[model samples]
Target chain A: MAPTEASERPSLERLLATREIMVACGPGGVGKTTTAAAAGVMAAVKHGGKVLVLTVDPARRLATALGLTGIGNKEHRVPDEAFAEAGLKSRGELWVAMLDTKQSWDDLIARHAPDEATRDEILANPLYQNISGRFIQSHDYIAMERLYEIHSEGRYDLIVVDTPPTRNALDFLDAPERMADFFSSRLLRWLIMPYRSRLVNVATKPFYQIADRILGTEFLGDISEFFILFQTMYDGFVERSRAVGRLLADRRTTFLVVSTLESVPLREAEFFAQELTSRHLHLGAMVMNKVLPEYLRGSEAADAAHTMAEQAGELGGLLSERMGPAHEPLRDSAQVTRVLKEISASFLNFQTVALREAEERDELSVAPEVMVSVPFFDTEIHDLGGLYRLGEQIWE
Target chain B: MNDLLDKKLLFVTGKGGVGKTSVATSLAFLAASRGQRVLLCEVDGKGDVAGLLESPPTAFKEREVSPGLFAMTMDTEEAMKEYLRLNLRVPFAGRIGPVAKAFDFLASAAPGVREILVVGKLCYEVREAHYDLVVVDATASGHIVGLLAAPQAVNSLVKVGLIRNQTDWMLEMLTDPAQTGLVAVCTPEEMPVTETIELAGRVRNETTVNLASVVVNRVLPELFGTQEEEVFETLTRPDVAAELELLVGSDTAPVLEAARLAVTLRRTRSVHLDRLREAIDPSVPLLYLPYLFTRSHGLRTTRQTATSLGEELGY
Candidate 1:
């Protein structure tokens, strides 16, 4: 695997890739939200047509970078003048949304089951009421379906999303299956067994006996009653999970493994890439965010290192008589060039490994590419106006 | 190799900043060294586990860096997406335009990825019968708990089919101490110590997985009595003007250099240790480590960290 920087690769922008659902995956704090936004914007502005830069629990950073605050699924008209200012035409459009899991779950119930009886039955299902439904349960499957609804509305060409950063950012990748399996499981149903009737009781009695023998079935029995009252819509959940799973696996989806130069984030990205490939998902690029580029030998870092060492030397001498000799090492490798060089190799090594791994994964469809962003400065951005400026760097 | 080969799941975790990534790599290396098929899994997005193993940062794709050490950073959400597609046999599974992105947003509506699902996936990996050790670099405490106990996290939210049952089974499997060993790493620092102890407590409270020893990274050698006084004396020397070359040889300069930085490190670390004393179990003796002479903390530094941790854990 040959390690290469993002700059080393050609900027291949295929905005229509949005026609395929792209999963921008990476570890936390690795500009995934921003890159997804940037990709969405690039797809819309450069490639043409309406693009929906839909974000789910996006970092305020992504919103700030996109020059839009309080942007959700509501199609905000980015005043023609603004797009013009960015040299983008008004011909394309974007719709933004934060995936409200509970809301999405509600929406799915409302849309699929028909009438309050069904919706309530489904929603109140103890099984559906399980922890997986609200967030872990039916949230992801419903949201993934919502993407289709938004797309079907013909409102946008691209829908960019910022996923939650937890568990290697692939929880979204696997949530639907888990949620569906949850709804499909008999555990919660068994919970309600004691409450429902003879059949339910009969089914749950065994578990109760087991519980009684081990941890006491009375408590578990009560929980089972609650479960029965809660998970009445077990069948509905299974149906919905199947529907959404079908939509996600559709050919139009693409998963972009996002990462930074750091080891943890990069490994997480690769894990995402591998998972996506195994599932037969289209992996477009490895968006390496906030990567530190190797600078020239006598550059700012060198100067900064020297100055810091000098100051530290003075501080050490002031602190102790024994510390006077310690300043030598501080001053010796002050430039940080050698260390930087090694880190650079380490960083590039990550890229090489990623690319090679991508190349090997037959299902990924594309080699692991790179998308590097600058390390964020601690400065604040006022609004979407600021996001536009930040977007300039992310796209390139 | 055969010893590790029988192990289906490898849950590698440590106190924050204890070089769990490095230890994960070494274990993978040890497993791989014997030609045992292995995988180094990084659950936290910080996926540098491969760096120490000298492999590219791989995602779900298990990229083989050496003979048998295949590595990957597991993305739980992405895994969730794939799970949906694969298990459910989602038809349009290929073109998930914005689908996963949306899934991600929704997943966040909760605390995080469901622990059971994540752990379930781990179980899946472990049961796959493909790789030997599915080494997982779990999240820092809260995140790990969320990932491992996701089933518990969303115990009330139910859908249908195998996914829900998967969580139950996973929760059950994870609680079986014989099946899983939970290794935790921590530095002697106060925050990490507190977190590690809390983490240990949670592992005990939440699941029955075995709590492996904690690995304290970048541990400093304790300089005692006269040697400490001599170091202090050298640094605080009043008469020496031109930075008295107290260092005579190659090692001397670094020793002196170490002596100089030692004060600040010791002061800060001393406070950290004091705070930690009350938190960590007294029986869990922290493994001491010397600051290595290096331009950067790289493979070598982390490799040593893993070796020390391994020694501590009697790996």
Candidate 2:
């Protein structure tokens, strides 16, 4: 189970071995977070290095399994004892950090602010408070900023980061560039200009009048004051964001697009993969999770199901008579027939879905370096053992 | 509480990939088929509503995709333009280009401005009585709270002006239980259920809108009852399965295994369903929609879902 061993098939293990950052991103509700954690766990156990998983949100039990409970904005090492508890031994350290968006934003402001007074004032600003707390795109921007900050520290050999669920998967990829542009835009200058100079030119007068009438003078003043306070940190913020953007485009950084075989999410993931290629970022792997079992697609099984459905009465009578002595429940021919019909119908129903999934797989337009399919587990993956089992399927 | 469709405005939201758009489209379809004039607006502008309806793509201008059913995709910039044209009466159409560009920048920087535009447009439809009902395919659970609370957020920030004045009526419409309601859709799974519960709490505490109902989508069918399940177990035993294979002239193991998988999946999901039932307020109706075992998703699937929804609503 050595992740470092070379195999004929390209595996996530081999991909993680070469990359410094592996970003797990896709449409939401596709087990992106769990896949990211499993990759981090496997890399630590098999590749023998300090592996860190920076995740936004994980299921309660999975978080507990990784010992990430109630800890935010701080990285915690997954103690060796937990691996022992899960009946495993890790060859290297594994760390986990949950992204705290508000805290991350405050930290970014603290880092970029020109002075302590400016930092305090910005932090206390109601507008700043609202943006840090409820701004949707702020989540996208801060996740990348935190990853950049963590990677620059050189603390781990590998960082597997799970992206926040975005309206569009491409949002985070463009967040840093957007942030940089926002700081240096001419409109931003115009926004804060009138307040600083107390003079409105003819060209800007209409803009001012409309803004004043629409948003009110008081609200406009609050916005002006917030931006003016933000102006002092503009250069630092712009430089930091650009560096974050560059880090994403670095050779060692790669993206893993996780998705299910469902049509809507598959379409979104395909668009994401294409976008990554278009942006010149490395698309390392595409892990399709919760795939229906291959056995469900076998012609032999389908034939059996069809036969059972067609001759349930005769089959039930025959089998019940043969097994009536050992199983009393089989003696009831009508009930046994019902059971046979139900199971067969259920099987045929699932076969249709499995076939649909196969068609969706075939229609996937983009191919990454590696494509992996993980079968749907009957039970939820809520523990370290479950994660390990899931990881092994994609490990090759 | 059962008057879900009777409300003038209904915002359907859920975690992504949980069939939120499908549920919203189905609700609109269901309403329209019941002889109600319905306007369906997609707030995210993903054009999923159009795909679900098998109609041409929707845009800022609402189009009649079906008889008595109109669909549109929300564009905050277009909404702002419409607002300027209608409310401000400022005939600056030639000059709106720069103003819109500037406003787009402001919408990005200012927290609730864009959200307010979307909510304001929907509320305006309700106010003008443009349709018997308006169904909005709103943002996912993660952002819906912010979107629903935008008017209040704007009110707290803006002390005076036209935008401030506009918030009063929108808030009035949104806060009224009879006029507005929110439907939270989710599947009986771990993440979607967890998020639905969390969203329920946030919507109750933070927003003025009413939680009209919770739609549990993709619910698996129970394959067997107690006695039948016992018989199924006995049939799955190795000796019985081997005999059955001989009789059927094919390997029955995979067929049986698929059934077992289905049963386990249903059992696991039922636990989460129970948790969701316990977590949500008892007064809010829980609507269950079966998992459609169809070959493709299109108008056919939408019709099936709408039929199921119609039955759930006691039609």
Candidate 3:
């Protein structure tokens, strides 16, 4: 590694400056979507590059956070005025989109089917509707497929992807391969063999009788028919899946594993990092979000405690004066000390959280090159102002 | 807790990162403490329940993580194998590598099939009455509705078959309020609360799973009354330094700053909590869990949370 790369932190600004693609991945509730949106804003405003953020969760969370209404499968540009209000004089634009799994599935079939007849046949199939419409992992496969499709267009300088929740994050990576394998599997091919040969159908009648006893005749026919139609387009689908695999493996694409200060997400991050390494994907940065700021620690903590103890009487007087005769019980010195102590305790709690976050970061020495930390925010971050403020922190 | 414990199956789900694992573990522990045999299951192979219970991770096999409490992770493949062995009576389904591979292909090729196997297995467990209560720590809230509706979706799609019969049985168990309950977990934040509200509506309309309650996790305490908050706000001003000189006879800047930040966090949480309270339907019971300030979310902290939650439920 270059000395510059070795020494410099893996901050969002660096990623925005150079990387074409950034996939924000982490456990659920770690603000992965928020981080991805913030990074997109950072890339557009600070780096003077056009950015696109793609989110895969069915919820319109990114759309809601960006203050955009009704995000569908298509790219919805965040208006210039929203960015202007955020005090960002960006030379580039930011566009956001949510993945529509059903739409993507239809689009994939439209692209890969050998002919209109075959496409219509497959799309009209009941099994195809159930599989393509409700297949849980299809979202994962189609998300990557959409990413590959959008990236090839060269429309945006940077694309930030908000992945599915952590529990299924790896599915997004593996589903494409699994989809391709399922299509090309020998078992499926053999199951559909009778569809191509009348002679084989005649020979397999007894076999069908026994199999129908187990899987039912209607299901057997549905499976065979669905596979026969799907088999016609198998080559096109497999090729696209392999292409998506290559695109994810491209050098320009990077992954930022987002986690929080806690043990569960950090442990999940470690597992994610290992999987990325095993898959030979570029692990760009490890972003630990929601880290509590270290307000008071060690001697400063003691100082706050001492100051609270000294000011207990005056603070009591202040609250007593404010509360008047109705709150006489609250004016006691003992009550005052308890309130002040709570304030100090909150600060100390934050200090402990911050320290623990640092310890968790230290444990991630395996992928120590690009690490960024975002502090926990007190206020809710919604709309352009929040994104801009969060983007500034990400850039920092 | 009694209402939830009474159901043979309880499915707990929430937005990503809303502490569903903790909530599920706490509920299971609470039920087990009430002397009910509780089986806690997690889908998506996260092993969060196992991790929180400080037990070694077990996939597809229920292990006694705590007394009267069992934990298991539902693997789609394992569920598929189990479904075949029990329902189809395929003798070699469990051990044959080719059969497993073919089953994986079938599941992958069909979208809702995997969900059926996993959810069907869960519903099957409930029907079998192996445990007095079964708690499934389902996938995040976003996908949970889809998981719950899978059996019905498959049932409606397939006309007549062994698969249909299996799905029909699972659907029957799922929709019966006496047989199943759905607990939605959330944090007092905009996204999680909004998602939880949406999930509640979906659960009511789409699935037979009863919306038992909403567990709001990681809530901060409201430490400041209106007047105290006003005083705190005034103290944050730089001019308060003059008053500090006379009162404490020293720089109270640290004290004021710490107090202000702490109060701000509480105020933020309170505002969000208000939003959550308003947004959620009043008919639904809202349970709040305080944020634990421990360094790690280990077993002891989890047990402490469970105890507090049990007390709150009056179990």
Best by DockQ: 2
As a whole number from 0 to 100, the lDDT of residue A239 in candidate 1 is 67
Ranking by TM-score: 2, 3, 1
lDDT of 1 by residue, B99-160 (tens): 44434433443333445446766787776767767677776553465455566554434433
**Error of model 3, residue B133, in angstroms:** 0.5
lDDT tens digits, residue span A1-396, model 1? 988764455442542443546656666545566667666665666566766666765655445445566666455544555566656664466556677656666676677564677677656645345443333324445556677677566666566655554433566666666766655555544444434463446534543442343223343444454445435555766665566667667767656676664444445566777777778776666665433222312233333333333354443344334433454322322222222223223223333433333333323333654344444322333334445555556565
lDDT of 3 by residue, B1-315 (tens): 456578899889998777888999988888888898999988876777776788898768888988899988888777766665675565564344445556666776665777887787877887788999999888788788778888887787677767777877887788788878888998877678778878888888887677887888988766666755554554454544445434554445655666676667777767767877786678667888888877887688788888877766766
Question: Whose lDDT is higher: candidate 1's or candidate 2's?
Answer: 2
TM-score of each: 0.49, 0.98, 0.90
- As a whole number from 0 to 100, the lDDT of residue B177 in candidate 1 is 53
Q: Under CAPRI classification, how is model 3 graded?
A: acceptable
Highest lDDT scorer: 2
- lDDT at residue B126 of model 1 (Cα atoms): 70
Order of candidate numbers by lDDT, starting with the best: 2, 3, 1
Misplaced by over 4 Å in model 2 are A1-9, A196-199
